[model samples]
Target: MGRLSGKVAVVTGASSGMGSEIVKLYAKEGASVVAVARRQNRLEELAASLADAEGKVEIFPGDISDKAVNEAMIDFAVEQFGKFDILVNNAGIMDDMAGVDAFSDEKLLKVFSVNVYGPFYATRKAVNTFKEQGNPGAIIHIASEGAYKTCAGAVYCASKAAVVALSRNTAYMYMHDGIRSNCIIAGGFKTEISTSMGMPNMEAYGKLKAVLGTAPEPGEPTEIAKACLFLASDDSAYVNGAELAVDGGWCAS
Candidate 1:
């Protein structure tokens, strides 16, 4: 049997990149998933692709930053799947690689709204659902290596730093209640976010990261998905409030 057999999970940003991969892996591992994102077609495509998987995938197209959407996502998961056991707060955006001096208030607010507020809103709903159902829950935050290092623009880093802090506090406050919260400090990956930032190809990106001295190459979405799987499964039952750096040693140097 798969590690997450019989579990129910909700993954944000499920339309693409790491989020899409996570949805696929979760279903493969025997978990019913509610895949949440803003793109209806993409979500539908994902759901269709997993039609023969070991579990189910239900799509929810909406913005994770909206409080109502967050609430509804949890509701959809529980109402559709019988229960919600895991939440992957994976929807996030990046700001132009501009310093604080050149950063506009709009840019700062937008990044924080998606990266920080979205997780907060969803986490609130998930925690409350676990409370109402009297069940243990796992909350996974897809943070960036930028949260711990200064390799990117200020707004994005600060926003993710807030995510790290929030995850830690959630774990501390809820461990006794059987709720677990953790952050994946992921390194550079060839996701839409990187392409949006105008980053070079993955090989070029790896070369750039190599300047930091013997770091691993840029990671794949599937790599991070696997790490998330570990955290979401009973394998991580004793892990809480931990920052798992699946960043290919970017934070090591």
Candidate 2:
């Protein structure tokens, strides 16, 4: 039951959905966790709810898109615990389903900032923290099916593609140091990520809905969390640079 005993984890986007589930499971499996998110109250509630877990849950409230915040979170974890062993870059925002012709400069910037830049900043900090500790660590980037298909808007798709590339490159770069990085090619799920898409482009949404209509039923948050646990634990010691599709066969179509 102690899958992650003695490890310390930092999970971004811990306020809800898969992020919340990941925190819960990691704590129960005996890993100290620092939950990072913009909502202070939500993070507090989340940490309190897991008070009886085998491991400890703490909050690091801030917008992960900020570079300094990213670095600070890992540092906070190390200060609170002895060292950091895992990083889950799960916090992300969705983009309005806008095609190339209708791309909004503001939307492009916002989506890239949160979805792409947030993970990049967090990864850099976590890698450094692991190196300082002289321990092998795991990095799991929550990518999307948008990386390979048109489920989301062009910008969102491009950002996810970049994330997959980041995971692969990071895995290759640190293979000699035993730092593993992997990407979760997520599929349709009943999550709050859509709330970020303020006023989606109608034409683009229509096309996306058509493609998604053929996909399998949406998955639950715990499903993705289980995959995260596998990657974070030593169960996947040999699994690196993989684009693990957790989309329930939606990507096969």
Candidate 3:
């Protein structure tokens, strides 16, 4: 049951969805967790809920796109739990449905900053933290099927594709240092990002859901959390630079 015993993990986008679920599961499996998100109250709630679990949970509120914040997160984890062992780069946002003709520089930059740059910043700091301790660590990045297919807006798809590349590069760069990196290519799920982007009503959300040809039932966040656990734990010690598709077979189509 102690899959991550004696581990310390930093999870971004922990306010809700897969990030939140990962925090809970990690703590349950015996890893101290630092949950980072913009919503302080939500993070607090998560920490409180994890009280009495096998491992501790701490809340760190910040925007992940900021390099300083990512650095601070690593520092805090080291300060609070000694040395960091895992990082789950799960924070992401959906872009407005716009093709190339309708895309704006602002939109493109914002998505790339969060989905691409944010992970880069976090991975760098996490690797540095691991290096400082001379211990091997694991990095789990939550990418999406949009990375390979045009399920979402052009900008969103491009950003995810970049994330896949980033994860692979991180794995290769740190292979000699015992730092492993992997990407989870998630399929359509009932995430806040998927359900609330320009879909004014349920009907509109449903229409877009149908058009995307996603599975009839969206994947639950817990499903993704399980995959994160594998990557975070020693179970995947040899699995690096791997892209595991956790979609509901959406990528198959």
Candidate 4:
């Protein structure tokens, strides 16, 4: 049997990058998946790809930073799949490079809204559902290496650090309920987020390869997806309040 057989999972930011991979992997492992994201078209495409898989997949599109959206996500999961087993709070954002003084309040709030409040709201909803359903479930937050290491700017790094602490404390608080919480500290990946942040187009991609002694190869979302699967599945029955680093050894260097 697959690792997630007889399970149902909800993954946020399900349209692309790590979130999309988590959604796909969970379904492949035999979990009925509720894919949540703001991009309805992308979510629909992902859902279609998983349609013929061993597990079921459904798509819900909305801005996770909104509390109403978060509540609807949980409601949709129950309405479609009957129960919830796992929640991957993976939606987030980064700001353009700016000094603390230079950063705009609007930008800071936007980042926090999606990165911090989004997960917080989603977790609250998920925990409530888990309690009412009387099912032991897992919640995994996709934090960044920034959470533990020094990184650019203040907002993104600080927000992620908060997420790390949130997961740890929540794990301890809900252990008796058989609900587990964890965070994945990921390294830099060549995702749309990076592209939007002006990482390198084809020309600069080559120049960077020449200068930085070759940029560290980006970590695949599937690798992180497997980690999420381990945590969500009974394989991690004893694992809780743990921060798993999927940083491709960036912390070592």
Candidate 5:
């Protein structure tokens, strides 16, 4: 049987990139997935593509930045699939590569709203559901190496740091309740998230050149999705509150 056989999972940002790969992987491994994202057509295509997979994929088209959407996404998973077991808080946005002095309040809000607040709301709802149903839960927050390294703009860095903290805090708070929360410190990867960066401050963008040079070739989304699969399955039952740096040794450099 597949690793996630009979599991029900909620994966945000499932319209494209890493989120899409995670949904595909989970379904292939036999998990019924609620692919949540804002693009209705993309979600429909994704769900249709998985029609022959070992499990099922249903679309939840909405913006996770809204608290109601986050809450409803989890509830939708349970309402549609009978129960909820995993939540991959993978929806996030990036900020322009600007320094603190060059950053704007608007950018900070936009970044944190999608990156931090969305996860916060989704996690809160997931925790309650897990406790009520008395089933083990797994939450994988897709953070960035920027959380600890100067690989991104100040706002992006700060946002991911919050995500890392949230993951650890949730893990500690719910360890005894059979819920696992972990952060994946990702390195440079080829994904559509760059579309959200908009534009970077030319001068401040140079700040990342040095550190970016140390990074290996960009990784594929499936590579990270594989690690997520491990954490989502019973394989990572003992691994909680961990920061698994899937960064190809870039952070070491």
Candidate 6:
């Protein structure tokens, strides 16, 4: 039997990168996944591909920064699959490089709204559902190495740090309720988000490549997805409030 056999999972930011991989992995492990993202066309394409692979996948397109959308996503998952077992808060944004004093308030707020508040809203809805059902559920947040290192701007780093803290506290507060919370402190993953943000310089990218060996090799979305699967499945029954780093040893150096 697959690790996630018979479970229902919800993955935000499911249109691409780590979120897309998480949805694919969950389905491969036999979970029915509700794939949430703002890109409807991409989500539909993902759903179709998963279906072709004999996996159950559903699409729910919306901005996770919106509370109503978050609630709707949970509701959609439950309505389609009867219950929700895993909630992956993977939707996030990174700001352009700027010193604290040079950062624009507009960019800072937008980054926080998506990176911090988006996960918070989703977690709130998921907690309510898990509480009502009284079943064991797992919440996984895709935080960044920025939470621990100073590579990213202040706003992005602070937002991710908040997620880590929130996950730790949630794990402690809801252990009795059979709800487990964990965060993945990822680093230098080659995703659209990274390319879109535009690194400070080619030197910075080259430095990361030298340390990690390549942009896309070590931190593939599929690798992160596997870790998330382990946490979501009964295989990790004892794991909670843990920060799993899928950074290809970048943090080590």
Top-scoring candidate (lDDT): 5
Q: Write the per-residue lDDT of candidate 4 for residues 67-138, one digit (tens) a residue.
A: 999989889989998889899999888765444655668768988899899999988888889999998999
Which run of 10 residues does model 5 get worst, by summed lDDT?
Answer: 199-208
Q: What's the CA error at residue 110 for candidate 5, in Å?
A: 0.6
TM-score of model 3 (CA atoms): 0.93
RMSD of each: 3.4, 0.8, 2.6, 3.8, 0.7, 2.8
**Model 6 misplaced stretches (Cα beyond 4 Å):** 195-218
| Weakest 10 consecutive residues of candidate 6 by summed lDDT | 207-216
Which scores higher on lDDT, 4 or 6?
Answer: 6
Q: The CA-based lDDT of model 2 is what?
A: 0.92
lDDT per residue for candidate 2 within 6-35, as digits (tens), equals 999999999999999999999999999999
> What are the lDDT figures for the candidates, one per model?
0.88, 0.92, 0.87, 0.83, 0.94, 0.85
Query: Tens digit of lDDT per residue, candidate 6, span 1-253?
Result: 5788889999999999999999988888899999998999999999988885434998998998788999999999999989998999999887765657657788778888888888988898899999998888999999988887766666777889999998999999999899999999987765778654644534343443443442234456788888999889898999999999888777676
Ranking by lDDT: 5, 2, 1, 3, 6, 4
Rank by TM-score (best first):
5, 2, 3, 1, 6, 4
Report lDDT (Cα) of residue 71, candidate 3: 90
Better of 2 and 5 by lDDT: 5
TM-scores of all models? Answer: 0.93, 0.98, 0.93, 0.91, 0.99, 0.91
Residue 14 CA error for candidate 4 (Å)?
0.7
Counted clashes in each candidate structure: 0, 0, 0, 0, 0, 0
Once fitted onto the true fold, the runs of candidate 5 whose alpha carbons sit more than 4 angstroms away are none
What does candidate 5 score in Cα RMSD to the true structure?
0.7
Cα-based lDDT at residue 195, candidate 3: 39
Highest TM-score scorer: 5
Query: Can you write out model 1's per-residue Cα lDDT over 1-253, one digit (the tens) per residue?
Result: 6778899999999998999999999999999999999999999999999999999999999988788999999999989989999999999887766666666687788888889999999999999999899999999999987786656677887999999999999999999999999999988787887544544234433433444354567678999999999999999999999999987777777
The ten-residue window of minimal lDDT in model 3 covers 196-205
Model 1 misplaced regions, further than 4 Å? 198-215
Clash pairs, candidate 2, are none
Error (Å) of candidate 1 at residue 103 is: 0.6
